[model samples]
Target chain A: MNPKFYRSHVLICTGTGCVSSGSNNIKSRLTAKLEESGLQDEVKVVETGCHGFCEKGPIVIVYPEGVFYCQVEADDINEIVEEHLLKGRVVERLLYTELGTEKKIPAYSEIDFYKKQHRIVLANCGRINPESIKEYIAVGGYEACGKALTEMTPEEVIAEVKKSGLRGRGGAGFPTGLKWEFTRQTPGDKKYVICNADEGDPGAFMDRSLLEGDPHRIIEGMIIAAYAIGADEGYIYVRAEYPLAIRRLEIALEQAREYGFLGENIFGSGFNFDLKIKKGAGAFVCGEETALMASIEGKRGMPRPKPPFPSVSGLWGKPTNINNVETFGNVPDIIRNGADAYRAIGTEKSTGTKVFALTGKINNTGLVEVPMGMTLREIIYDIGGGVSNGGKLKAVQIGGPSGGCIPADLLDLPIDYESLQEAGAMMGSGGMVVMDETTCMVDVARFFLQFTQSESCGKCTPCREGTKRMLEILDRICSGEGREGDLELLEELGDHIVSTSLCQLGGSAPNPVLSTLKYFREEYEAHIKDKRCPANVCAGMSAAYVIDPETCIGCTACTRVCPTGAISGERKQPHVINSQLCISCGACAEKCPVGAIAQG
Target chain B: MKSLEELRKLRAELEKELAARNSEGKPKIIIGMGTCGIAAGAREILQAVLQELEKRNLDVITTQTGCIGMCEQEPLLDVELPGKERITYGKVTPKDVERIIVEHVVNGNVVEDLAIARLEEGGI
Candidate 1:
């Protein structure tokens, strides 16, 4: 009997979010307190990865008891040690309460935010120590890699992936199995497998979190992918911005090598496979496969015209297969769990799960992985806890900056590749930015158009010039300088750009503008015809502010915050605005406690 | 690490260790300190718990974790004894620390009213 055997396990999140909020210091304090109290041997401390809800970082969870504690600091460690650890008492005042709930929900799965989520790619995230290979193996991690190498053949592996009906989770819904099969079939002496971790979507963190939380899973996935395609060497092209994810990957790779998973003949089967990391130098367009290959090649990181697809000739002119991080992450599970289990999860056409980064005005904004067939309403209202601050949902911006804004009417649309495409929105890497009623659709289009316009590689004239022209028209319309035929001209130019663009970046750039125009034409009409921004989001469209005499209390708060000093009044009397001097900044409106300051 | 047989043997060995670790025979306490937990003052609550325990000169194991996606009822904590059902207490403050220790940890009695969740015999 081991007396030193710990009875309690404490899991603290060492994910980037929690670490930023000083979780490391909190952890050290806990360790010190445990040592001081002579209770060090009974408790085991483990630092796991992100628990998805980053808003309440510096999080802590205790096992068996299943208690949840958030935002722990060094200052709070003493009381926690005294009351909870020493006395075996739970602190009553600091319990997490929502909607004034009387009871604490200790289990992580039963929480409202996770009630609807089906985590597949995110299975080990926040559950295991990302840096520990033993912890990874404890949760049936590398068994897939072992299973693939020992039990299955190269062709059999690809066949199983195909039978699973898994599609590429990267923007394009290309079949993963087919991509592997193409590279496998193509005649080549040496081949390569690449994991596209260049997740450039602005409002997305799914790939970054996946890499950070479970790096071994990805390594296993890539190893399986490499084995399937008969590829010996691999590269994971991760963005330079994701330093935490990168560091974890480096650690995981070294561990995998030590564990005899990477860089050798696996299980004495004579199949050789290994990998290297290529850091992307911050180009959004490099997310494209050709551009990514070009970057890896130490070239200018530009997309070339595809006649010989990457499968036939890629990365030093060898047969290659590229799949997104999430796509590859799903592969190991498919092989281990069997094709039928993966197939049964989602709809007939689209199988397996999709990890979405849910950001923007929605409540419970976090990383959510749902089966492919789940409706937008379920994602927004059920899992997301509806719009934040009691606001009405206006639209959901799917994909990246270039993805479409699906209106509230289309919330019933199933979140799959084909359905989203049919609805004029590409499921481009699962960046879902929710919008409230206050968001101006015209301005959103303009914002996306500006992003696309600036990121154009200038390889094609239509994408370069056409996106700029569309951006100019959108800017003019937002600035209340629109002509009658501006919208029509934008439509015409947008169509031309989509058809003629060389790469996917230039091609999909107009989707935001087109989708917004298709869904919210009335808002555009208001901007052009009535000279009014209905959502009141556009700055120049609505250019005046006035003090509502009935609502005003002559509060000096607004006067103090007002940059132009346009507001003036005596104490206890209604304030008057100097209209000539007012900059229409709406700072006073924000500063006013009452509904006194009105902007138009 | 090299062969399938070795892998299976290691699996069995690790499984035994896991079983030993999970076999419930002592009191345990878990806390939800995910980002949601932190925002709800879980840190202060955690610290307060430690202080209270030290004052009583008792022994316990306190740990924290990321959000279990319960943003609404965050800063949640759970208490379990050697054989007692796991009881979850919600909206806990430092003020409620002593009673939780006295009524629950020492007496093996669950602070039922403060509990949000429990492992009931019949069903959840």
Candidate 2:
């Protein structure tokens, strides 16, 4: 440490969110102002990756004090440097207000969003400079790889991981250690280890953030796995959509090779393990380990039958092991902190922290890493600050298209493999999207079905044809062409698809439809029986919004904003909406001065 | 960096240097100059803070960072005493800077009204 250097460090997030919002200007302005005041040497400025608080980007974090700032501008840098940096006085206006709190400006943990979170995979995300190998080394990034390769035998490494009780994070919840053991025992001349970075879930971004924020951690994990499974080569199958993650991974690979962590004679232990990055074609089905391996082998991405399950036959028909980016990211922590330490964090069944991307109608929409078995209610109301716009929460859709929609009543459902499975939801890459009362449950089901239907590779007879038939039923019901037995038909198709599917993609394809049917059958009944959308959100619903005669106070307020001029009335008189002219745009309802508009 | 033994030695040395930098003996302050705070008039509040501290001849380090995910309550500030729990203040004005310094910094008392977030559990 240089004696003339700054006594404090200010980290600004230049991640995609902050950069687009002008965090670069904030950095330069902060530096320029500090240099002018002769305090540049006393204060160091570093730009880091995404802090997961993208909603309040242009985030600034001052270390030692650890005061968090959000939505910063170039104009605010001068004040921050002058007031908070120089005078030993905090600038009250720049502090972040804890979500869901009445008055307290939460420190990082006090923020309910972060209180339940336990950082393991995201241990160094916003804390260190990913581009700097030395910064990573300072925080024990590659120490796990060293420990695994040098001291621990291959069997000892596997045993430690098995004891950690970490299940797969890629929705399946398979044991990571068991997978490695299967591959190790499989007879093969050249075994392979592949990191499944093809995160294709609709709202999922945890894998992308992990890969971008700490690429070395994943590389270290892969290296340690190679040493454990006695593999010589590894491949990282990442989705091409994530350019930033891909770039960082590439940079990290080059740096690791330079540092003698990769290539021949790693740590001088003579365990030569090399890695290659393969950009995926953005196929959702390729997220399945089999399909991902097939894609890596220069073939079409499609799911194949298991039992010979990657462990026995994978990636050019060799004994290969596959794990998601998040699963591998946890390996380093488990190695560094020991299995018992990791096992102590979560429930008996599910161990360690799970990173969740909290999005949709929640107030504090970002990424949160909470321990396993936290209730949905705490994650939503306490951490996510309930629904945005002061609307009541209708339901939370977790685990993407293959996962299930947990209703508002089951808000206390503990988030774990067994608990979530019983609730008809799976932890699919940790996408927890909180939906509000305005969100139509039927439409949500239809939207998920549509995503799955399009992403289906059509290799299996059940999912390929079953999803099409179910989607057609959903379309008819949504467009006001519903019959009495359409719901039953959907249930039957879901059961058949789950039973007869060839792969997990085919097997779990009916989750959205089945879950929505089981939990929200009332909404479907209303759509069919009353021909009305209770939320009035569906476009083709028969419900027409009308102004009540008793409530309409002769106000022509709705007449002006009506795009189609469907509302007609004179000044100081009750207005009527012509059903023919109304496009059901809800403009008159929105423009109504009184709470008179009703939809039924 | 080549072997495990060398790597462990480097880690110890680096950790020592890092620890020395964060001795907890020096007073520090931070401003939440993120997008939300900036939009909520934190720039001026920050200026007032600097002017107040400068007027009092108080020496401390100040810095800015992105949002802490609490955009609703922008214009945030956190004060760190050597060994004491960090006290965060919210919705501060140029006028509140003096009271925070006089009461909290000088007299070892926290202004409860302005004190918002406490940073004892998770500092960074």
| Interface CA RMSD, all predictions | 9.0, 8.2
**TM-score, first chain, each model:** 0.94, 0.95
Candidate 1 yields a Cα-based lDDT of 0.83
Candidate 2 residue-wise lDDT at A316: 92
Candidate 1: where is the Cα deviation over 4 Å?
A1-4, A92-95, A99-103, A547-562, A565-581, A587-600, B16-124
Q: For model 2, how does the per-residue alpha-carbon lDDT over A437-544 read when each residue is reduced to its tens digit?
A: 888888899998999899899998789999999999888888878899999999999999999988888788899889989999999999888877777778858566
**Model 1 Cα lDDT, one tens digit per residue, A265-313:** 8887788899999999889889989999999999988899996999999
State every prediction's TM-score relative to the real structure: 0.84, 0.84
lDDT of each: 0.83, 0.82
Superposition error at A432 for model 2 (Å)? 0.5
